[model samples]
Target: MDTVAANGTGGDVTAKIAGVQALLRGLTILDVLADSPDGLASLADIAARTGLSPSTAHRLLSTLVERGYAGREPGSKGYVIGHRVVHFSTSVRRRTSDLRRLVRSHLEAITAETGETSNLVVLDGKNVVYIDQVEGTHALRMVPGIGSIFPAYTSASAKAILAYQVDDAQLDAVFTAEPRIKLAAHTLADRRDFVAALTAVVKHGYAVEESELAEGVSCIAAPIRGRNGVALGAISVPGPTQRVLEPAPERLGVLLKKHALHVSQALGFRQLSCAAG
Candidate 1:
């Protein structure tokens, strides 16, 4: 027994080494699949990329597919990253939870003051996704449901973040990836017009939308900046166009900016005024 444990021929030791090697090979396959431009790879391509035998690659890939880490692309027979991996990519969900905790009071205050539904949103890919909301007290209001997604260009919340982005390439990418569409009569469908709108957002220190996303609805939003001064997300108040655009758009814009700046400061973005002293 002692000699068996010393590494000559121990079943448990051999099993442990084999398990680790299999785990490593499986991870290598996953990396190759993820690195594909379209997130797909044929079995032959995966085997060649991983430098594994065809039989070994097939076995590992079969296990991966069975376990949901990979799946076959429809009609392609090529392995693609699975829904499980896509779900894992949303680890931002965890970060958003922390963000909601940090910003919930701000959302509530916006709702209380504006009598409009307030939302916390973050840019995901080329879209803005609502993660949290505080409903208005009024019977008539608009609340883009949590987990709702909207084109970045068509959303005031997304424009708030895009207006502060220092990377022009990112803005260009959004246009290149998705064709501009007229979601409503006032939608900024042309790239040049969209860019100008974002520029105005920066100049005005906030963003607004009047029936651009949905008819009879309007929104005002301000960016929440990170330590580097890039927007991490936005705080927005959206409501019936009559209420949101009535009284004064600037009034809502100013209120949103004040609270958004506070949230940005809480998140470690030091304003020039605060940094100067």
Candidate 2:
């Protein structure tokens, strides 16, 4: 055990404890507010969500308001996250490698191996943005390039990333906001079907699409995860459906998973192998 006697009055220790508790409570309130659709929360709602008393929640919220991290709503008198949180989030996004710097090599390698177009996609508000791409040498090919946005539910790369990264509520929200509009005849239309497809992808460690995005194109996708086990994006190889489904889907799946793991390692994922029980 380690113990240090207070050099000054006990008030200092109590103040420090109170400050730490307030900080934790304030952060919890921020999280609740961020997750809400309106970005505002009442004190009772914050207290219920944070397991804090009403007075404690009020004090924590007041401190946050004083610090300019939260502001009071006019009509409801609820607290909403302020400008500081947005600034901090924007700074973090700016610091991270923006699409091209992160997945270019993986795209190139997939193109080289499969002689097909490769794409790197990230989630953007119910859609997937094609941030980077490498074209194949085929005479006729599908060419999705940077700045192209596609529905997330219909894209293999987007589904692969979403399966590992997003929660159930977020996934529900995505489907609710963007219902399946039939990009192709085989596109998943319902939540149950989509969930089943994602579950299969997670179990097999990769995803495959056959004529979902286009008439004759097929794609194989695998997730690229970071250190925290959250998927940053997905690496995909797209070609004519005949080539991908020719002999064995399992073999193609293996190749996709292997390359995905290599890219994930490059992106700082530390694989954890579980022991047999």
The TM-score leader among the candidates is 1
State the weakest 10-residue window (summed lDDT) of model 2.
Answer: 1-10
User: CA lDDT of 146 in candidate 2?
Assistant: 55
lDDT of 1: 0.80
- Tell me the tens digit of each residue's lDDT in model 1 across 57-106: 99999999999988989898799877676565466667678778888999
Error of 2 at 9 (Å): 52
lDDT of 2 by residue, 1-277 (tens): 2234455546678889988877777876776665443457788888887788999889888888898888899888789877686566455445445545766777777778778787776666565666667998888777755545566677788778877863665576568752245656677757677877887787888888888766787878888787666777777777788777567666567777887778777767767732110
TM-score of 1: 0.66
lDDT of each: 0.80, 0.71
Q: Evaluated with lDDT, which candidate comes out highest?
A: 1
**Clashing pairs for predicted structure model 1, backbone only:** none
Off by over 4 Å in 2: 1-99, 273-277
RMSD from true fold, candidate 1:
10.7
lDDT of 1 at 138: 87
